[model samples]
Target: MVYFNERDLCYNSIYPHNNSWTMSRIELDACAECDLLLTPARPAVGDKARCPRCGYLLQRPRKQSVARTFALSLTGLILILPANLLPLVGIKVLGNTRDGTLWSGVLTLYREDMWAIAILVFLSSILVPLINIVLSVLVSGHLYFRRPNRYLPYWMRWLQHLEEWAMLEVYMLGIIVACVKLASMADLRFGFGLYAFIALLIVNALLASCLDPYLFWRRIEQLQHNHRHEN
Candidate 1:
């Protein structure tokens, strides 16, 4: 049975129908963009549910979401250090060579008294992405193991909001622009870190694609409910 709270516009389920059942599970959820209350259908794998009014996507089922997200997030976590710490590119001009790493770039900006830009870059390019990946791992890992954690809901909420602030693609675009501008002026060489950064970017993209937020919220709710009953 689906019990919806009108006050918060959230649904609480009791004895939710199994996926194997012929009937689609009904759950109430509010559209994030329009705040319209909706009873989204449980989408089949490869299917999607959309808000009728705004056309905002409400749900999309991803097969093996927990395992896929966990693996990709772990890979991203492994790549983060090298991507930020190691030199991304090397430049040579008149027998002088200089290499640039993400961390070094932020430090350079700060040293030049562009602290505001430095902090912005650091948060958007590095810190936020790290947090996003870490939270993905934590939430997906617990869900994969069928372990319940009271903080899962909080982590998932943060993960959803943090997606916008993780600007790795923007940073990569800036790198490409700089490389094109410098190509005519000096010898340019790509570093291992560049490849690592690219891989991390791809993994993050895949992680986002594989995560099913609707499924995750339902699983977290079920897990927490079961835990409370057991206690």
Candidate 2:
């Protein structure tokens, strides 16, 4: 991927690589992530393009992408309770066994005076996931409804902000590391919450991958534009 100035992208797209190419086609597209001007090319259904500089997905048109993302977001949101309330794992230590849910673990930590770590764990693992799921649903809902939204930019920015803090991947890595360390120390058992967590990660990641912010913004722009014309 090549880094491109937003100005250059806009300008070059107006200019031409060659007169013949320009004469034949004149559509210009911008990379959502980098604002790199891309010559528009019609792609097959399964085709996808990525920005060379940022590896940001440029275009990947699909049937029902917004609908699918909305569905996935709903599924993830529904799983939130199971992922946190059910037992994440059962642990056996010195012949004593106990099953621990996320809240249970947090309570245990708090009781043990590890409030800071407990808070950190709860926020990253629980709260962040919830916010990400909720925001995803909202974003996809807007696309699905295609309503006039004056706060489109703010909505997208809010989602992006929440996205940066939603650390399910990091928390999962921490869990894996902890599991490995505890292998020899005790008998470890995976539980419903653990499975739910895994599923949540899969669904949320899928939602993120399917969502194209650029497409979202464009849709919003079109809707607002149409609304204006109607008015």
Candidate 3:
């Protein structure tokens, strides 16, 4: 069952469904854009509902979306180890070969006194992905355990905001471009870490792209409600 206090949404006291004898919770929600009262239809998997007034997408119930996201997040998290620990690229310059990990790039930048770029690279390329993986695990694991963090709503919202700043995919593209430019001058070989980094990039992209705020709130509500009753 879904429950929301209208006051939280700046309700106008307009009761479109004023009729009595309601068995369900009315499936009511407000559009974030226009505050239109929307009673979402029970959509099947892969189906979407749109608000009639403003054409905003109300809901698209993707089955196992949370599970899929969790799996990808876990995979990306595992890849982070190899992505940083193993060598990412092997450059053969004049028949002398050397490989470097992601951290090595950051260290190189730091050694050159390019602190700003080095920090940016470390945060966006490494720290951001780590945060996303942790957030996904924490939130998704809470839901799985039917437990509530009490501040999970705020935590989840904060995570969403942080997600906007992640640049792992762009970082990967930069790596690809760099390799392409150096291909003629040196025989470039990808290391195991590079392969892991690529996989992490793909899953991280999917995790960020397919996430739905509405669905997240809904799941949080369910977990919180269940936890309260269990007390």
Candidate 4:
């Protein structure tokens, strides 16, 4: 039997269904309610509900998510420097050794008449990571400092939207495939850059997940509130 006390938000009163009870609670705001669990249909004012977890509000981000995301993004940016500079993969076949950095990989593709693949590799491995990291850092820093950066939010939204295209892990997969195939023919020695690139992928994943657009907006709201109070 399903029943709820009057104090329970899920509970009901006047016309209780045969299988359930009713309760009443003040609905403060959608941002503070169980929005994620609510039916696709938007919640009406005065509606009683609670989030599946914590039962507080589904929209509110964990307080530290912003800081953590910023930190991870910064760390990823720092790693990117070494990942590109150091030799990512090395091949020593029959005592003949060859090493390549991220750019060299792109150049190799180009020299092999793999123009399309070269461009893709360049974009995914180099351009995309640079753009995503720089934008993430800028957006997070703006929010952290409580700066009035209208464009920062726009950039953050775009970064979040474009995350799937970054494909850092995909690049890593390509590297692994190349390494495996080359190792079969020659001795392969992974370099510091290869490990750094791998670490970068994990760090980038965490950075993206930790960033929450809603949380940044909340910061903006707080800044606005303070400005009004001052005025």
The TM-score leader among the candidates is 1
- List where candidate 2 sits over 4 angstroms from the true fold: 1-44, 52-56, 111-114
Clashes of 2: 3
- Angstrom error at residue 65, model 2: 1.5
Better of 3 and 4 by lDDT: 3
Q: Write the per-residue lDDT of candidate 1 for residues 45-149, one digit (tens) a residue.
A: 878777766777778888999899999999999999999888899999999999999998899999999999999999999999999999999999999998999
Q: Write the per-residue lDDT of candidate 4 for residues 1-231, one digit (tens) a residue.
A: 111112334423533657544321222223344343232222333243335444553332444776787889899989999999999888887788899899997899999999999998888879888888988888777677767654755786778677777888987887888877887798888899988998898998777556655556657566655766777
After TM-score superposition, the amount by which residue 46's alpha carbon in candidate 3 deviates from its true location, in angstroms, is 1.0
Ranking by lDDT: 1, 2, 3, 4
CA error at residue 149 for candidate 1, angstroms:
1.3
lDDT of each residue in 108-209, candidate 2, tens digit only: 899999999999888877887798788778777877888666776677778877787778888789788989999999999999889998999899888878
Question: What overall lDDT, based on C-alpha atoms, would model 1 receive against the true structure?
Answer: 0.87
Write down the TM-score of every candidate. 0.87, 0.76, 0.80, 0.70
Q: Is candidate 1 or candidate 3 better by lDDT?
A: 1
Q: How much is the lDDT of residue 68 in candidate 2? A: 89
TM-score of model 1 relative to the true fold? Answer: 0.87
lDDT of 2 at 101: 80
Global local distance difference test of model 3? 0.76
Candidate 3 residue spans exceeding 4 A from truth: 1-28, 33-37, 50-58
Model 4 lDDT-worst window of ten: 22-31
Candidate 1: residue pairs that collide: none
In candidate 1, stretches whose alpha carbon ends up further than 4 angstroms from where it belongs are 1-26
